[model samples]
Target: MPSHPNYSNQGNKFAPAKTSLREAGDLYGQKEFHIYQNAIEKMRAHDDQLPSLPIITLEIRKATSNPNVNLNHLSSLIAKDPSLTAILMKHASSVFYRTADKPKNLQDVIKRLGMGAIESLTLSHSIKSLFVLRNHQLKALYKQAWQRQTLKACMSYHLAKTLHFPNPEDAIVASLLSEVGTLALLSSLQDYAAPAAPTYKILCQHYSKHLGAILLAKWGVSPVFVDVLRKTGAWTLDTGRLLQLVDVINLGLFHTIHYLQPQNDLIPLQEIAAFKKLNPQYAMIKQQKLLIIEENISHILQLQKNFE
Candidate 1:
């Protein structure tokens, strides 16, 4: 038996656990495995260094919670960060903002995006900056994780549309932010001496979702999104045909990796319980997986460009 390789950076949590050759065909939860216990213990040491919830994000979330809240004050807070303000400007002009009445200024962008879109994009741009690590090797690893997340986001959006999900944007945000725990774990271990990549991955599997939940709660991300984030690690956890954000991302993520690995065979959609629950025929997914991923790749990147 060969060792199961965790897909570098994509962090596809849904596949069957990869067993080491020594433990071939055996099953073990990486999170509960004892080998990486010491590495997992190190995760909490740098909570203080984890990025603080950006103030503008908080203000916007607060405003969203209160119907009577002053929109001007919320817009003012966002405008304080010129970079964020610029991102909003670009988004307001995007096709996602397909209004005959184009936004003329920051206030218009605010009105155009509303509380939900604003919150998603603000946190996406603001919080991701916190992933920076002084260690060059760790920094490169973090970049791969972050890029994988963008693709996941796109896939979630497309999957939601295919499945007729009520709110695709929420699914996209949940997918993108689900990897925060992995990012935090990498940051925590960046300075750890001589970490074997396998050991590092074990620690990641054990703790990434939990860390993501903590960061999202601290950042004031809505619990709906947080619940979806927490559920990503349970790749096979399905709740019937009533598809939610978690299911959307799980299916999207599985296909995203399949698209990326054109030369190799992927786990069939028929065998994946998550894909089966969506009511698409096994043959339908096999036929359309590439187009689903490739089409959404352009759409998702275009959305990111709007924020860029």
Candidate 2:
């Protein structure tokens, strides 16, 4: 069994609350673990079937990596997907991306937004498309996961803004991809004849980080985002170095879990090394207050409505 970097010894006084998961692993004997490994191998063999961005998007991603890639080349790729074309045009004309006049076509959108914003939008949609699972039984599961992720993304956005982080959208993107590992794992099990087994869920937790990075790489997601997948769930990491994005993600997870299950024993914010670096007073965000019971219930609703 491939083990993740032990997240427990953050050198903090509090022990990591991975006991439930670790205990779950213990409950699954060697035979159960092998069943998952075999299923995972079966899924990996049919890699092409895994949901991903259209080839055009992947091509644009590769082309954009070249600093000197021509803008016309990008336009050509964007024109290939009508769905992508419509989405880019609609968003490019929205209040945020709109120029003085509405852009008429894909070429106009690229020119107006520039390659950086265009790339992010493309990657965002590309990654999100994977969440539209083919398995109908998983619809309820996807909805629960998507809603939770949206909440975390919203928390990350406000946290980044409050901390004066330059890119709040990074936090949102990170939040969405945070569950990639589990999602990828479950999708691989779509053809596994067994019911959604307990050991499969446990295995997803164990190997999610590694599997997530692979999926992101396949989609040509930026390395920074790949790094985000690795570290956001790490509670005890030195927040001083990766203070803004990484710390905001940790905070987002904490609050999202706290909202979902008020009594969850995942690390307290005050005790977390990342939150400690913040002023803790939340002085920057005077207007927006979270509720003690619901704990940002309105924010959760707003995020679901916006992202859904």
Look at candidate 2 and tell me the lDDT of residue 286. 21
Off by over 4 Å in 1: 1-40, 45-49, 99-102, 161-164, 193-196, 233-235, 263-265, 277-296, 306-308
Report lDDT per candidate: 0.64, 0.62
Kindly list the per-residue Cα lDDT of model 1 for residues 177-281, writing each as its tens digit. 777777887777655552455555655655776677678766766787887776663556665666667777777777667655543455556565566665543
Which candidate gets the maximum TM-score versus the true structure?
1
- Per residue, candidate 2 scores C-alpha lDDT tens digits across 1-308 of 56664221111222133446566657465665677677766656566656677677668777766788887877888888777787677656654444678997777887776666566556666655675556666555555555666667767766775577766657767776766666666566555443244454456556666677667777666687777788866778774654757777877776666556555446655567676676645623321223321444564455445455
TM-score for model 1? 0.77
Model 2 TM-score, all chains together: 0.70
Model 2, residue 8: distance off in Å is 17
TM-scores for all candidates: the values are 0.77, 0.70
